[model samples]
Target: MSARNPGTKLDLQWVSKVRVNTQAVLKRAQQIQGLKTPKKQWQAAWLLKAVTCIDLTTLAGDDTPSNVHRLCLKAVQPIRCDLLKSMDMHNKGVTTAAVCVYPARVPDAVKSLKAANSSLPVASVATGFPAGQTPLETRLQEVRLAVSDGAAEIDIVINRTLAITGQWEALYDEICQFRQACGDAHMKTILAIGELGTFTNVYKASLVAMMAGSDFIKTSTGKETVNATYPVAIVMVRAIRDYYLSTDTSTESLLWLALIKEELGDDWLHPHLFRLEILSSDSLQIYHGTSLSYVSH
Candidate 1:
């Protein structure tokens, strides 16, 4: 895992200058998705990796502790024991990257993981999740309460009003406050890209979130009509690559970039810097067997 992106000062000029070529993004995404995929054991191995990156989530109006516990159990053993054994991964201690739920359900997830003796982190959606129209003070308090409830990760919703209206500074400041409230817990800033209305806005929001010290810049909240898509992901990862590059200075930066470029192709695409919140298991299965294009991105 690389060091957490300690975000630099917000650069409005850079943010304003950011651009996304939609046609190019679409073409590259298609090319990546069209690549040939692995088969049999190879496919299984990739699916297992997909399982590990999942933020196994359940966010509903009627969620209960029993259901949360069941979700945690599934997170601990995402695949059946026999299936893992067949794949020769039964004793590998495989688990989803984390378990996500409402802020109020954090304790349930923590208790369940503890009872199961599993160390899976509990990720809570806070700051007026799904719809972030609450008062700023209330929203910030929500983050604090979730952290106090034992959430190791906070998935916060950015105020799309600010992004859509071109209020970049307000948006960056708001996210910075949310990041502060997260304290030691990692922050996954949800850009809610679908609602931002343009690829350029999506790209800009991704940069602002990273610049505000977000641990991971996620694509969507799964509440939008359009959730995660390859085109949007490409734009986001490119911004991540740009941010990684910007962190370096002249000669040393060039050396480090070359080293990472060779040693870890698309190294910024890992779970630490990026995450995709999918709506169904079917998409995960498709990503696993058909193409690493979607999975790798």
Candidate 2:
């Protein structure tokens, strides 16, 4: 999104000093969930914003070039042209934030995007996605390969074992290697908060990822048993804000727009600094519903 986070040396002191008041975090999350959502045109506008920040993803095992091509085309035109015309947003160049797929599917996504004459980015998941159990050298090479295949963004998973076992330095070192492997491509670090044990460890991992140069710190891999929960997201965004205040370097947030608005304010809600990874079908469904509501009213 913004400039790449150059990253800082491992601040063991800061990482160690972090703590989470579980009950307080739970209370804040409940309050946010109880808040009211936008209605009518305002609801449509929010949906539009979400569409632009979506990373349309297809990580299925049966993924093929044809389906990847289809995914790219949908990303290029996420909403119906007629509905956009009704909203007078047809010329706004609205589209999904990016299209994400596995490394083997990067080339397919790149080729399809080019054929469509669209500049949408192709993001690839590397570093033993869903599980960071791979050897160090192998994970690094996986990142390099994805970049070589034209992945504009690389989503790498952190080794949960390191975070759980209090290996902050090791976690930071591994992420730094991934940053180098990314070269010019943006790096989005997945904390996989689900397996990171407690809220405290999740906050620690988020800080370590930012300190190690993650342009964007993400919540889950969509494969985890607990993906992107409100409580976990609250911890991660706080880490993002804390990192910015200390380093003056902004890290993007992938939590919900409403949550970002409440936690980090409106500035962080833009697509450049915020993203939502969603399935193509789910995004399309939401888009369809929002557009119909806007057109009917």
Task: Give Cα distance to truth, residue 47, candidate 2, Å.
Answer: 0.6
lDDT of 2 by residue, 219-290 (tens): 888787777778888888888778777875213122266887888787766656778878644431110000
Q: Total clashing residue pairs per candidate?
A: 0, 0
Q: In candidate 1, which residue pairs get closer than 3 Å at backbone N, Cα or C atoms, i.e. clash?
A: none
True-vs-predicted CA distance for residue 7, candidate 2, Å: 0.9
Worst-scoring 10-residue span by lDDT in model 1: 284-293
Alpha-carbon local distance difference test for all models: 0.74, 0.82
List ranges where model 1 is wrong by over 4 Å.
1-3, 249-270, 273-297
lDDT of 1 by residue, 24-137 (tens): 989876765655555687666655665676778888888899999999999899899999898788999998878889998999999999999998889999999988999999
RMSD of 1: 6.8
lDDT at position 28, candidate 2: 89
